[model samples]
Target: MPRAGRPASPLITRRAAADAALSLIDSGGLDGLSLQAVARVLGVSAPSLYHHFRDKEELLTQVARCFLEEIGHQQERWSDDWETRTIELSLATRRVALRHPNAAPLALRFFPRKLMLPAYERSLVDCPYPPQFHAVILEAVEKFTYGSALFAAAAEAHHTPAMPPVDEAHFPYLASAIAAAPASDEDLHVEALRALLDGFRVRYGPRQR
Candidate 1:
Protein backbone atom coordinates (compact mmCIF):
# COMPACT_ATOMS: atom_id res chain seq x y z
CA MET A 1 0.00 0.00 0.00
CA PRO A 2 1.30 3.46 -0.82
CA ARG A 3 2.43 5.13 2.38
CA ALA A 4 -0.21 7.62 3.40
CA GLY A 5 1.19 11.07 4.06
CA ARG A 6 1.10 11.66 7.79
CA PRO A 7 -2.47 12.53 8.74
CA ALA A 8 -2.85 16.28 8.25
CA SER A 9 -2.82 18.07 11.56
CA PRO A 10 -6.31 19.08 12.53
CA LEU A 11 -6.77 22.71 11.63
CA ILE A 12 -7.47 24.70 14.77
CA THR A 13 -8.37 28.33 14.41
CA ARG A 14 -8.03 30.70 17.34
CA ARG A 15 -11.78 31.20 17.35
CA ALA A 16 -12.43 27.46 17.44
CA ALA A 17 -10.03 27.03 20.35
CA ALA A 18 -11.56 29.92 22.24
CA ASP A 19 -15.05 28.57 21.64
CA ALA A 20 -14.04 25.11 22.83
CA ALA A 21 -12.52 26.67 25.92
CA LEU A 22 -15.75 28.53 26.55
CA SER A 23 -17.77 25.33 26.22
CA LEU A 24 -15.48 23.64 28.72
CA ILE A 25 -15.98 26.58 31.02
CA ASP A 26 -19.73 26.40 30.63
CA SER A 27 -19.77 22.75 31.66
CA GLY A 28 -17.02 22.75 34.30
CA GLY A 29 -16.28 26.38 35.12
CA LEU A 30 -12.85 28.03 35.20
CA ASP A 31 -11.58 25.46 37.67
CA GLY A 32 -12.12 22.53 35.35
CA LEU A 33 -10.59 24.25 32.35
CA SER A 34 -7.15 23.33 31.11
CA LEU A 35 -5.29 23.34 27.84
CA GLN A 36 -5.59 19.58 27.94
CA ALA A 37 -9.30 19.78 28.52
CA VAL A 38 -9.77 22.16 25.60
CA ALA A 39 -7.64 19.97 23.39
CA ARG A 40 -9.75 16.97 24.29
CA VAL A 41 -12.88 18.85 23.39
CA LEU A 42 -11.28 19.76 20.04
CA GLY A 43 -10.11 16.18 19.49
CA VAL A 44 -6.45 17.15 19.48
CA SER A 45 -3.52 16.59 21.81
CA ALA A 46 -2.74 19.17 24.45
CA PRO A 47 0.53 20.07 22.72
CA SER A 48 -1.39 21.00 19.61
CA LEU A 49 -3.19 23.69 21.55
CA TYR A 50 0.17 25.33 22.21
CA HIS A 51 0.35 26.14 18.54
CA HIS A 52 -2.47 28.60 19.10
CA PHE A 53 -2.27 29.39 22.80
CA ARG A 54 1.04 29.79 24.54
CA ASP A 55 -0.35 28.70 27.92
CA LYS A 56 -3.48 28.22 29.92
CA GLU A 57 -3.43 31.88 30.96
CA GLU A 58 -3.36 33.01 27.32
CA LEU A 59 -6.17 30.60 26.57
CA LEU A 60 -8.17 32.04 29.45
CA THR A 61 -7.49 35.60 28.31
CA GLN A 62 -8.79 34.69 24.89
CA VAL A 63 -11.86 33.18 26.49
CA ALA A 64 -12.54 36.41 28.36
CA ARG A 65 -12.05 38.42 25.17
CA CYS A 66 -14.50 36.15 23.38
CA PHE A 67 -17.02 36.56 26.19
CA LEU A 68 -16.79 40.34 26.00
CA GLU A 69 -17.05 40.18 22.23
CA GLU A 70 -20.34 38.36 22.65
CA ILE A 71 -21.64 41.16 24.86
CA GLY A 72 -20.52 43.74 22.29
CA HIS A 73 -22.40 41.90 19.56
CA GLN A 74 -25.49 41.76 21.76
CA GLN A 75 -25.34 45.51 22.29
CA GLU A 76 -25.08 46.34 18.58
CA ARG A 77 -28.84 46.66 18.27
CA TRP A 78 -28.98 49.52 20.77
CA SER A 79 -30.74 52.61 19.52
CA ASP A 80 -29.17 56.08 19.31
CA ASP A 81 -31.08 57.23 22.36
CA TRP A 82 -28.52 57.34 25.14
CA GLU A 83 -30.74 56.37 28.04
CA THR A 84 -32.34 53.60 26.07
CA ARG A 85 -28.96 52.45 24.87
CA THR A 86 -27.68 52.36 28.43
CA ILE A 87 -30.60 50.24 29.56
CA GLU A 88 -30.28 47.91 26.59
CA LEU A 89 -26.56 47.44 27.08
CA SER A 90 -26.94 46.72 30.77
CA LEU A 91 -29.65 44.17 30.11
CA ALA A 92 -27.57 42.59 27.41
CA THR A 93 -24.67 42.16 29.81
CA ARG A 94 -26.91 40.48 32.33
CA ARG A 95 -28.47 38.26 29.70
CA VAL A 96 -25.12 36.98 28.46
CA ALA A 97 -23.83 36.46 32.00
CA LEU A 98 -26.88 34.40 32.89
CA ARG A 99 -26.30 32.28 29.81
CA HIS A 100 -22.81 31.36 30.97
CA PRO A 101 -22.83 31.72 34.73
CA ASN A 102 -19.80 29.49 34.94
CA ALA A 103 -17.75 31.81 32.75
CA ALA A 104 -19.11 35.12 34.02
CA PRO A 105 -16.35 35.59 36.56
CA LEU A 106 -13.79 35.63 33.79
CA ALA A 107 -15.27 38.94 32.67
CA LEU A 108 -14.19 40.45 35.96
CA ARG A 109 -10.84 38.71 36.05
CA PHE A 110 -9.72 39.65 32.57
CA PHE A 111 -11.68 42.70 31.53
CA PRO A 112 -10.50 43.87 28.12
CA ARG A 113 -10.88 47.60 28.65
CA LYS A 114 -9.22 48.52 25.37
CA LEU A 115 -11.77 46.49 23.45
CA MET A 116 -14.60 48.19 25.35
CA LEU A 117 -13.39 51.78 25.22
CA PRO A 118 -14.49 52.54 21.68
CA ALA A 119 -18.08 51.60 22.35
CA TYR A 120 -18.06 53.58 25.56
CA GLU A 121 -16.74 56.62 23.73
CA ARG A 122 -19.59 56.34 21.28
CA SER A 123 -22.04 56.14 24.14
CA LEU A 124 -20.55 59.27 25.66
CA VAL A 125 -21.07 61.11 22.39
CA ASP A 126 -24.76 60.24 22.59
CA CYS A 127 -25.06 60.99 26.30
CA PRO A 128 -26.94 64.12 27.26
CA TYR A 129 -24.69 64.77 30.20
CA PRO A 130 -22.32 67.73 30.22
CA PRO A 131 -18.83 67.05 28.89
CA GLN A 132 -17.32 67.13 32.40
CA PHE A 133 -19.66 64.45 33.69
CA HIS A 134 -19.48 62.13 30.71
CA ALA A 135 -16.62 60.04 32.04
CA VAL A 136 -18.15 59.76 35.49
CA ILE A 137 -21.53 58.75 34.15
CA LEU A 138 -20.03 56.18 31.87
CA GLU A 139 -17.94 54.72 34.67
CA ALA A 140 -20.91 54.59 37.01
CA VAL A 141 -23.13 52.85 34.49
CA GLU A 142 -20.48 50.31 33.58
CA LYS A 143 -19.66 49.56 37.20
CA PHE A 144 -23.27 49.00 38.10
CA THR A 145 -23.95 46.88 35.04
CA TYR A 146 -20.97 44.57 35.58
CA GLY A 147 -21.58 44.27 39.30
CA SER A 148 -25.25 43.48 38.85
CA ALA A 149 -24.52 40.90 36.18
CA LEU A 150 -21.92 39.18 38.35
CA PHE A 151 -24.22 39.08 41.35
CA ALA A 152 -27.10 37.81 39.27
CA ALA A 153 -24.96 35.08 37.77
CA ALA A 154 -23.70 33.95 41.16
CA ALA A 155 -27.21 33.94 42.60
CA GLU A 156 -28.51 31.92 39.66
CA ALA A 157 -25.73 29.35 39.97
CA HIS A 158 -26.42 28.90 43.68
CA HIS A 159 -30.21 28.95 43.35
CA THR A 160 -30.30 31.74 45.90
CA PRO A 161 -33.70 33.05 46.91
CA ALA A 162 -34.32 36.68 46.12
CA MET A 163 -35.47 37.32 49.64
CA PRO A 164 -34.38 35.19 52.55
CA PRO A 165 -36.80 34.14 55.27
CA VAL A 166 -37.03 36.81 57.95
CA ASP A 167 -38.97 36.93 61.21
CA GLU A 168 -41.56 39.68 60.95
CA ALA A 169 -41.90 39.99 64.69
CA HIS A 170 -38.32 41.21 65.24
CA PHE A 171 -37.73 42.78 61.84
CA PRO A 172 -41.07 44.16 60.77
CA TYR A 173 -39.66 46.94 58.60
CA LEU A 174 -37.29 44.62 56.77
CA ALA A 175 -40.04 42.11 56.28
CA SER A 176 -42.39 44.75 54.93
CA ALA A 177 -39.76 45.98 52.46
CA ILE A 178 -39.10 42.46 51.29
CA ALA A 179 -42.82 41.85 50.88
CA ALA A 180 -43.12 45.01 48.73
CA ALA A 181 -40.11 44.24 46.59
CA PRO A 182 -40.28 42.74 43.11
CA ALA A 183 -40.45 38.94 43.27
CA SER A 184 -38.03 38.23 40.46
CA ASP A 185 -34.43 39.38 40.10
CA GLU A 186 -35.19 40.52 36.58
CA ASP A 187 -37.86 42.89 37.81
CA LEU A 188 -35.65 44.22 40.56
CA HIS A 189 -32.80 44.70 38.14
CA VAL A 190 -34.94 46.77 35.78
CA GLU A 191 -36.40 48.80 38.60
CA ALA A 192 -32.96 49.58 39.94
CA LEU A 193 -31.66 50.58 36.51
CA ARG A 194 -34.58 52.91 35.98
CA ALA A 195 -34.01 54.52 39.34
CA LEU A 196 -30.33 54.93 38.58
CA LEU A 197 -30.98 56.46 35.18
CA ASP A 198 -33.54 58.81 36.67
CA GLY A 199 -31.00 60.08 39.15
CA PHE A 200 -28.48 60.58 36.38
CA ARG A 201 -31.00 62.48 34.32
CA VAL A 202 -31.84 64.84 37.15
CA ARG A 203 -28.22 65.49 38.04
CA TYR A 204 -26.78 65.69 34.52
CA GLY A 205 -29.68 66.26 32.20
CA PRO A 206 -29.57 68.79 29.31
CA ARG A 207 -30.10 71.61 31.79
CA GLN A 208 -26.60 70.96 33.17
CA ARG A 209 -25.13 71.18 29.69
Candidate 2:
Protein backbone atom coordinates (compact mmCIF):
# COMPACT_ATOMS: atom_id res chain seq x y z
CA MET A 1 0.00 0.00 0.00
CA PRO A 2 1.07 3.56 -0.61
CA ARG A 3 2.01 5.55 2.45
CA ALA A 4 -0.96 7.63 3.60
CA GLY A 5 0.87 10.69 4.84
CA ARG A 6 3.92 12.80 4.23
CA PRO A 7 7.24 11.04 4.62
CA ALA A 8 8.69 11.33 8.12
CA SER A 9 11.96 12.85 6.94
CA PRO A 10 12.69 16.08 5.12
CA LEU A 11 14.45 14.21 2.34
CA ILE A 12 11.44 13.79 0.10
CA THR A 13 12.75 12.70 -3.28
CA ARG A 14 11.25 13.51 -6.71
CA ARG A 15 9.62 10.08 -6.95
CA ALA A 16 7.98 10.53 -3.58
CA ALA A 17 6.74 13.97 -4.55
CA ALA A 18 5.35 12.62 -7.81
CA ASP A 19 3.62 9.82 -5.91
CA ALA A 20 2.05 12.37 -3.60
CA ALA A 21 0.88 14.43 -6.57
CA LEU A 22 -0.55 11.33 -8.18
CA SER A 23 -2.46 10.57 -5.02
CA LEU A 24 -4.01 14.00 -5.14
CA ILE A 25 -4.96 13.45 -8.77
CA ASP A 26 -6.44 10.05 -7.96
CA SER A 27 -8.67 11.62 -5.37
CA GLY A 28 -9.68 14.88 -7.05
CA GLY A 29 -8.50 14.79 -10.67
CA LEU A 30 -6.11 17.20 -12.41
CA ASP A 31 -7.54 20.24 -10.70
CA GLY A 32 -6.25 18.91 -7.40
CA LEU A 33 -2.62 18.61 -8.47
CA SER A 34 -0.33 21.59 -8.07
CA LEU A 35 3.21 22.01 -6.79
CA GLN A 36 1.99 23.88 -3.74
CA ALA A 37 -0.65 21.28 -3.11
CA VAL A 38 1.88 18.46 -3.42
CA ALA A 39 4.21 20.22 -1.02
CA ARG A 40 1.43 20.51 1.53
CA VAL A 41 0.63 16.87 1.12
CA LEU A 42 4.27 16.12 1.80
CA GLY A 43 4.40 18.54 4.76
CA VAL A 44 7.26 20.44 3.18
CA SER A 45 7.87 24.01 2.14
CA ALA A 46 6.56 24.69 -1.36
CA PRO A 47 10.01 25.98 -2.30
CA SER A 48 11.50 22.66 -1.25
CA LEU A 49 9.72 20.87 -4.05
CA TYR A 50 11.60 23.00 -6.55
CA HIS A 51 14.77 21.16 -5.63
CA HIS A 52 13.31 18.01 -7.14
CA PHE A 53 11.21 19.52 -9.96
CA ARG A 54 11.99 22.70 -11.79
CA ASP A 55 8.31 23.55 -12.10
CA LYS A 56 4.82 22.13 -12.14
CA GLU A 57 5.06 21.34 -15.86
CA GLU A 58 8.20 19.27 -15.30
CA LEU A 59 6.54 17.45 -12.42
CA LEU A 60 3.45 16.73 -14.50
CA THR A 61 5.60 15.45 -17.38
CA GLN A 62 7.30 13.10 -14.96
CA VAL A 63 3.94 11.84 -13.77
CA ALA A 64 2.95 11.11 -17.37
CA ARG A 65 6.22 9.25 -17.96
CA CYS A 66 5.61 7.22 -14.83
CA PHE A 67 2.27 5.93 -16.11
CA LEU A 68 3.80 5.00 -19.50
CA GLU A 69 6.45 3.04 -17.66
CA GLU A 70 3.66 1.28 -15.77
CA ILE A 71 1.91 0.36 -19.05
CA GLY A 72 5.21 -1.04 -20.32
CA HIS A 73 5.51 -3.15 -17.18
CA GLN A 74 2.01 -4.54 -17.65
CA GLN A 75 2.97 -5.80 -21.13
CA GLU A 76 5.92 -7.82 -19.83
CA ARG A 77 4.22 -11.26 -19.74
CA TRP A 78 1.34 -10.80 -22.16
CA SER A 79 0.02 -13.78 -24.11
CA ASP A 80 1.63 -14.86 -27.38
CA ASP A 81 -1.58 -14.69 -29.40
CA TRP A 82 -1.31 -11.50 -31.41
CA GLU A 83 -4.94 -10.50 -31.09
CA THR A 84 -4.87 -11.37 -27.42
CA ARG A 85 -1.75 -9.29 -27.04
CA THR A 86 -3.50 -6.34 -28.67
CA ILE A 87 -6.52 -6.63 -26.43
CA GLU A 88 -4.46 -6.98 -23.28
CA LEU A 89 -2.20 -4.09 -24.21
CA SER A 90 -5.20 -1.88 -24.92
CA LEU A 91 -6.77 -2.85 -21.62
CA ALA A 92 -3.53 -2.24 -19.81
CA THR A 93 -3.52 1.30 -21.18
CA ARG A 94 -7.16 1.72 -20.23
CA ARG A 95 -6.56 0.54 -16.68
CA VAL A 96 -3.91 3.16 -16.09
CA ALA A 97 -6.04 5.94 -17.61
CA LEU A 98 -9.00 4.93 -15.51
CA ARG A 99 -6.86 4.86 -12.41
CA HIS A 100 -5.58 8.36 -12.99
CA PRO A 101 -8.22 10.01 -15.10
CA ASN A 102 -7.07 13.49 -14.20
CA ALA A 103 -3.45 12.88 -15.00
CA ALA A 104 -4.26 10.68 -17.99
CA PRO A 105 -4.98 13.56 -20.33
CA LEU A 106 -1.53 14.98 -19.69
CA ALA A 107 0.13 11.69 -20.42
CA LEU A 108 -1.94 11.08 -23.50
CA ARG A 109 -1.28 14.56 -24.85
CA PHE A 110 2.24 15.44 -23.74
CA PHE A 111 4.12 12.27 -23.07
CA PRO A 112 7.00 12.15 -25.54
CA ARG A 113 6.55 9.87 -28.55
CA LYS A 114 10.25 9.00 -28.42
CA LEU A 115 9.74 7.51 -24.98
CA MET A 116 7.32 4.99 -26.53
CA LEU A 117 9.90 3.75 -29.04
CA PRO A 118 11.30 0.96 -26.90
CA ALA A 119 7.92 -0.70 -26.39
CA TYR A 120 6.66 -0.32 -29.96
CA GLU A 121 10.05 -1.35 -31.33
CA ARG A 122 9.73 -4.58 -29.44
CA SER A 123 6.28 -5.06 -30.96
CA LEU A 124 7.84 -4.79 -34.43
CA VAL A 125 10.39 -7.44 -33.53
CA ASP A 126 7.75 -9.81 -32.18
CA CYS A 127 5.00 -9.21 -34.73
CA PRO A 128 4.71 -11.78 -37.52
CA TYR A 129 3.11 -9.46 -40.07
CA PRO A 130 4.98 -7.29 -42.56
CA PRO A 131 6.18 -3.93 -41.21
CA GLN A 132 3.42 -2.03 -43.00
CA PHE A 133 0.72 -4.32 -41.65
CA HIS A 134 2.25 -4.14 -38.20
CA ALA A 135 2.19 -0.35 -38.32
CA VAL A 136 -1.43 -0.37 -39.46
CA ILE A 137 -2.43 -2.70 -36.66
CA LEU A 138 -0.63 -0.62 -34.10
CA GLU A 139 -2.07 2.68 -35.31
CA ALA A 140 -5.59 1.32 -35.48
CA VAL A 141 -5.45 -0.24 -32.05
CA GLU A 142 -3.92 2.85 -30.48
CA LYS A 143 -6.62 5.05 -31.98
CA PHE A 144 -9.33 2.79 -30.64
CA THR A 145 -7.75 2.29 -27.24
CA TYR A 146 -6.77 5.87 -26.50
CA GLY A 147 -9.97 7.33 -27.94
CA SER A 148 -12.08 4.95 -25.87
CA ALA A 149 -9.98 5.48 -22.79
CA LEU A 150 -10.32 9.25 -23.07
CA PHE A 151 -14.06 9.01 -23.56
CA ALA A 152 -14.33 6.71 -20.57
CA ALA A 153 -12.30 9.02 -18.40
CA ALA A 154 -14.28 12.05 -19.48
CA ALA A 155 -17.59 10.25 -18.91
CA GLU A 156 -16.51 9.44 -15.37
CA ALA A 157 -15.47 13.00 -14.73
CA HIS A 158 -18.71 14.47 -16.04
CA HIS A 159 -22.39 13.62 -16.36
CA THR A 160 -23.58 11.37 -19.18
CA PRO A 161 -26.26 13.04 -21.22
CA ALA A 162 -29.77 11.64 -21.14
CA MET A 163 -30.90 10.44 -24.52
CA PRO A 164 -33.79 12.31 -26.04
CA PRO A 165 -36.80 10.36 -27.17
CA VAL A 166 -36.31 9.28 -30.78
CA ASP A 167 -38.84 9.43 -33.57
CA GLU A 168 -39.71 5.84 -34.36
CA ALA A 169 -40.77 6.93 -37.85
CA HIS A 170 -37.41 8.54 -38.63
CA PHE A 171 -34.66 6.89 -36.57
CA PRO A 172 -36.00 3.71 -34.99
CA TYR A 173 -32.86 1.65 -35.29
CA LEU A 174 -30.61 4.35 -33.88
CA ALA A 175 -32.91 4.81 -30.91
CA SER A 176 -33.09 1.08 -30.32
CA ALA A 177 -29.33 0.74 -30.46
CA ILE A 178 -28.84 3.58 -27.96
CA ALA A 179 -31.44 2.12 -25.63
CA ALA A 180 -29.80 -1.31 -25.72
CA ALA A 181 -26.28 -0.04 -25.10
CA PRO A 182 -24.38 -1.16 -22.01
CA ALA A 183 -24.67 1.32 -19.13
CA SER A 184 -21.09 0.92 -18.00
CA ASP A 185 -18.54 2.81 -20.06
CA GLU A 186 -15.97 0.10 -19.54
CA ASP A 187 -18.29 -2.56 -20.91
CA LEU A 188 -19.11 -0.44 -23.91
CA HIS A 189 -15.41 0.05 -24.57
CA VAL A 190 -14.84 -3.72 -24.48
CA GLU A 191 -17.54 -4.31 -27.08
CA ALA A 192 -16.15 -1.57 -29.28
CA LEU A 193 -12.63 -3.00 -28.99
CA ARG A 194 -13.84 -6.47 -29.92
CA ALA A 195 -15.62 -5.08 -32.94
CA LEU A 196 -12.49 -3.20 -33.95
CA LEU A 197 -10.35 -6.30 -33.52
CA ASP A 198 -12.82 -8.28 -35.59
CA GLY A 199 -12.54 -5.77 -38.38
CA PHE A 200 -8.77 -5.96 -38.22
CA ARG A 201 -8.86 -9.76 -38.49
CA VAL A 202 -11.05 -9.54 -41.57
CA ARG A 203 -8.94 -6.88 -43.24
CA TYR A 204 -5.47 -8.06 -42.30
CA GLY A 205 -6.03 -11.79 -41.81
CA PRO A 206 -5.16 -13.73 -38.64
CA ARG A 207 -1.77 -13.77 -36.97
CA GLN A 208 0.43 -16.84 -37.37
CA ARG A 209 -0.68 -19.90 -35.44
Candidate 3:
Protein backbone atom coordinates (compact mmCIF):
# COMPACT_ATOMS: atom_id res chain seq x y z
CA MET A 1 0.00 0.00 0.00
CA PRO A 2 1.12 3.61 -0.67
CA ARG A 3 1.90 6.03 2.11
CA ALA A 4 -1.01 8.10 3.53
CA GLY A 5 0.73 11.45 2.96
CA ARG A 6 3.62 12.88 0.88
CA PRO A 7 4.57 11.89 -2.64
CA ALA A 8 4.87 8.24 -3.37
CA SER A 9 7.98 8.56 -5.48
CA PRO A 10 11.24 9.80 -4.03
CA LEU A 11 12.13 11.49 -7.32
CA ILE A 12 9.27 13.99 -7.18
CA THR A 13 10.65 17.33 -6.00
CA ARG A 14 8.97 20.73 -5.62
CA ARG A 15 10.50 21.96 -8.88
CA ALA A 16 9.34 18.83 -10.63
CA ALA A 17 5.80 19.26 -9.37
CA ALA A 18 5.78 22.93 -10.37
CA ASP A 19 7.07 22.05 -13.83
CA ALA A 20 4.39 19.43 -14.22
CA ALA A 21 1.73 21.91 -13.12
CA LEU A 22 2.99 24.46 -15.65
CA SER A 23 2.87 21.82 -18.37
CA LEU A 24 -0.73 21.15 -17.47
CA ILE A 25 -1.47 24.88 -17.71
CA ASP A 26 0.26 25.13 -21.08
CA SER A 27 -1.79 22.24 -22.38
CA GLY A 28 -5.14 22.85 -20.68
CA GLY A 29 -4.89 26.37 -19.20
CA LEU A 30 -5.67 27.50 -15.63
CA ASP A 31 -8.91 25.57 -15.51
CA GLY A 32 -7.01 22.36 -16.08
CA LEU A 33 -4.49 22.97 -13.33
CA SER A 34 -5.39 21.38 -9.99
CA LEU A 35 -3.50 19.50 -7.32
CA GLN A 36 -5.16 16.32 -8.48
CA ALA A 37 -4.33 17.08 -12.10
CA VAL A 38 -0.72 17.82 -11.26
CA ALA A 39 -0.52 14.68 -9.21
CA ARG A 40 -2.03 12.72 -12.04
CA VAL A 41 0.55 14.15 -14.41
CA LEU A 42 3.36 13.23 -12.06
CA GLY A 43 2.00 9.73 -11.43
CA VAL A 44 1.29 10.44 -7.77
CA SER A 45 -1.63 11.02 -5.45
CA ALA A 46 -3.24 14.41 -4.93
CA PRO A 47 -2.34 14.53 -1.28
CA SER A 48 1.31 14.23 -2.19
CA LEU A 49 1.29 17.76 -3.55
CA TYR A 50 0.59 19.13 -0.07
CA HIS A 51 4.12 18.10 0.87
CA HIS A 52 5.63 20.79 -1.38
CA PHE A 53 2.70 23.21 -1.40
CA ARG A 54 0.33 23.85 1.47
CA ASP A 55 -2.60 24.38 -0.83
CA LYS A 56 -3.61 25.32 -4.36
CA GLU A 57 -3.00 29.01 -3.66
CA GLU A 58 0.55 28.37 -2.51
CA LEU A 59 1.19 26.21 -5.56
CA LEU A 60 0.01 28.97 -7.88
CA THR A 61 2.11 31.52 -6.05
CA GLN A 62 5.20 29.40 -6.59
CA VAL A 63 4.37 28.92 -10.27
CA ALA A 64 3.93 32.65 -10.77
CA ARG A 65 7.15 33.37 -8.92
CA CYS A 66 9.05 30.94 -11.12
CA PHE A 67 7.77 32.54 -14.32
CA LEU A 68 8.37 36.07 -12.96
CA GLU A 69 11.92 35.12 -12.04
CA GLU A 70 12.50 33.83 -15.57
CA ILE A 71 11.02 37.02 -17.03
CA GLY A 72 13.25 39.13 -14.78
CA HIS A 73 16.34 37.44 -16.21
CA GLN A 74 15.23 37.80 -19.85
CA GLN A 75 15.91 41.57 -20.07
CA GLU A 76 17.69 43.11 -23.05
CA ARG A 77 21.01 44.89 -22.67
CA TRP A 78 20.62 48.38 -21.23
CA SER A 79 20.20 51.21 -23.73
CA ASP A 80 21.32 54.87 -23.37
CA ASP A 81 17.73 56.12 -23.70
CA TRP A 82 15.36 55.18 -20.90
CA GLU A 83 12.38 55.49 -23.21
CA THR A 84 13.90 53.11 -25.70
CA ARG A 85 14.64 50.70 -22.93
CA THR A 86 11.04 50.97 -21.73
CA ILE A 87 9.65 50.10 -25.15
CA GLU A 88 12.12 47.25 -25.46
CA LEU A 89 10.95 46.02 -22.07
CA SER A 90 7.35 46.05 -23.25
CA LEU A 91 8.23 44.06 -26.33
CA ALA A 92 10.23 41.59 -24.29
CA THR A 93 7.31 41.17 -21.87
CA ARG A 94 4.88 40.63 -24.73
CA ARG A 95 7.19 38.02 -26.21
CA VAL A 96 7.39 36.19 -22.93
CA ALA A 97 3.60 36.21 -22.51
CA LEU A 98 3.09 35.03 -26.09
CA ARG A 99 5.40 32.11 -25.41
CA HIS A 100 3.26 31.13 -22.41
CA PRO A 101 -0.27 32.18 -23.20
CA ASN A 102 -2.15 29.89 -20.85
CA ALA A 103 0.21 30.76 -18.03
CA ALA A 104 -0.40 34.48 -18.61
CA PRO A 105 -3.88 34.46 -17.07
CA LEU A 106 -2.61 32.82 -13.88
CA ALA A 107 0.15 35.38 -13.56
CA LEU A 108 -2.30 38.14 -14.28
CA ARG A 109 -4.98 36.89 -11.91
CA PHE A 110 -3.06 35.83 -8.83
CA PHE A 111 0.05 37.98 -8.90
CA PRO A 112 -0.52 41.32 -10.52
CA ARG A 113 2.02 42.95 -8.19
CA LYS A 114 4.76 40.55 -9.30
CA LEU A 115 4.22 41.21 -13.00
CA MET A 116 6.61 44.16 -13.29
CA LEU A 117 10.21 43.47 -12.36
CA PRO A 118 12.13 45.92 -10.15
CA ALA A 119 14.59 47.02 -12.84
CA TYR A 120 11.78 47.80 -15.24
CA GLU A 121 10.01 49.75 -12.49
CA ARG A 122 13.16 51.85 -12.00
CA SER A 123 13.39 52.58 -15.71
CA LEU A 124 9.79 53.76 -15.75
CA VAL A 125 10.52 56.05 -12.81
CA ASP A 126 13.30 57.71 -14.81
CA CYS A 127 11.14 57.93 -17.92
CA PRO A 128 10.07 61.43 -18.95
CA TYR A 129 6.39 60.65 -18.66
CA PRO A 130 4.76 62.29 -15.62
CA PRO A 131 4.10 60.28 -12.46
CA GLN A 132 0.36 60.17 -13.16
CA PHE A 133 0.84 58.55 -16.57
CA HIS A 134 3.34 56.00 -15.34
CA ALA A 135 0.67 53.82 -13.75
CA VAL A 136 -1.63 54.32 -16.74
CA ILE A 137 0.99 53.30 -19.31
CA LEU A 138 2.18 50.35 -17.31
CA GLU A 139 -1.34 49.05 -16.76
CA ALA A 140 -2.22 49.62 -20.40
CA VAL A 141 0.82 47.75 -21.66
CA GLU A 142 0.20 44.84 -19.30
CA LYS A 143 -3.49 44.57 -20.22
CA PHE A 144 -2.69 44.70 -23.92
CA THR A 145 0.02 42.07 -23.66
CA TYR A 146 -2.14 39.73 -21.60
CA GLY A 147 -5.07 40.12 -23.99
CA SER A 148 -2.81 39.54 -26.98
CA ALA A 149 -1.44 36.38 -25.47
CA LEU A 150 -4.95 35.01 -24.95
CA PHE A 151 -5.89 35.91 -28.50
CA ALA A 152 -2.82 34.17 -29.89
CA ALA A 153 -3.47 31.12 -27.79
CA ALA A 154 -7.05 30.94 -28.95
CA ALA A 155 -5.92 31.34 -32.56
CA GLU A 156 -3.51 28.44 -32.15
CA ALA A 157 -6.40 26.37 -30.84
CA HIS A 158 -8.31 27.25 -34.04
CA HIS A 159 -10.78 29.51 -32.23
CA THR A 160 -11.85 32.39 -34.46
CA PRO A 161 -14.19 35.26 -33.73
CA ALA A 162 -17.68 34.94 -35.17
CA MET A 163 -18.21 38.34 -36.60
CA PRO A 164 -21.24 38.93 -38.82
CA PRO A 165 -20.51 39.88 -42.39
CA VAL A 166 -20.04 43.65 -42.50
CA ASP A 167 -22.50 45.76 -44.44
CA GLU A 168 -20.60 48.78 -45.71
CA ALA A 169 -23.68 50.98 -45.98
CA HIS A 170 -24.80 50.34 -42.38
CA PHE A 171 -21.47 50.99 -40.64
CA PRO A 172 -19.26 52.38 -43.36
CA TYR A 173 -16.43 53.85 -41.30
CA LEU A 174 -16.21 50.99 -38.82
CA ALA A 175 -16.34 48.40 -41.57
CA SER A 176 -13.77 50.25 -43.61
CA ALA A 177 -11.33 50.49 -40.71
CA ILE A 178 -11.76 46.81 -39.86
CA ALA A 179 -11.19 45.81 -43.46
CA ALA A 180 -8.10 48.03 -43.70
CA ALA A 181 -6.54 46.98 -40.39
CA PRO A 182 -3.43 44.77 -40.34
CA ALA A 183 -4.30 41.09 -39.81
CA SER A 184 -1.01 39.92 -38.30
CA ASP A 185 -0.78 39.76 -34.51
CA GLU A 186 2.54 41.56 -34.27
CA ASP A 187 1.35 44.36 -36.53
CA LEU A 188 -1.72 44.98 -34.41
CA HIS A 189 0.39 44.95 -31.23
CA VAL A 190 2.91 47.41 -32.64
CA GLU A 191 0.18 49.70 -33.92
CA ALA A 192 -1.56 49.76 -30.56
CA LEU A 193 1.70 50.38 -28.69
CA ARG A 194 2.60 53.24 -31.03
CA ALA A 195 -0.76 54.87 -30.52
CA LEU A 196 -0.44 54.61 -26.75
CA LEU A 197 3.13 55.90 -26.74
CA ASP A 198 2.10 58.76 -29.06
CA GLY A 199 -0.45 59.90 -26.46
CA PHE A 200 2.30 60.06 -23.87
CA ARG A 201 4.45 62.06 -26.29
CA VAL A 202 1.65 64.54 -26.90
CA ARG A 203 1.06 65.14 -23.20
CA TYR A 204 4.57 64.98 -21.72
CA GLY A 205 7.21 65.04 -24.45
CA PRO A 206 8.37 63.15 -27.52
CA ARG A 207 11.00 61.27 -25.59
CA GLN A 208 9.09 57.97 -25.75
CA ARG A 209 8.59 58.25 -29.48
Which candidate leads in lDDT? 1
Give the runs in model 2 whose Cα sits over 4 Å from its true position.
1-10, 73-76, 159-171, 179-184, 206-209
Candidate 1 is scored at a TM of 0.89
Model 3 ranges with Cα > 4 A deviation: 1-10, 43-45, 73-80, 112-120, 130-133, 147-158, 161-170, 206-209
Scored by TM-score, the top model is 1
- Can you write out model 2's per-residue Cα lDDT over 89-184, one digit (the tens) per residue? 888888888777777787776677789887778667766566668878788888888887777666555645334568877998998897799886
Local error of candidate 1 at residue 1 (angstroms): 25
Candidate 1 vs candidate 3: the TM-score winner is 1
Worst 10 residues of 1 by lDDT: 1-10
For candidate 3, write residues 79-162 as lDDT tens digits: 668656655656666666666767765666667474556754776767777787777777776677657655665554444552
The reply for model 1, stretches above 4 Å from the true place, is 1-10, 206-209
Q: The CA-based lDDT of model 2 is what?
A: 0.78
Worst 10 residues of 3 by lDDT: 154-163
Model 3 TM-score is 0.72
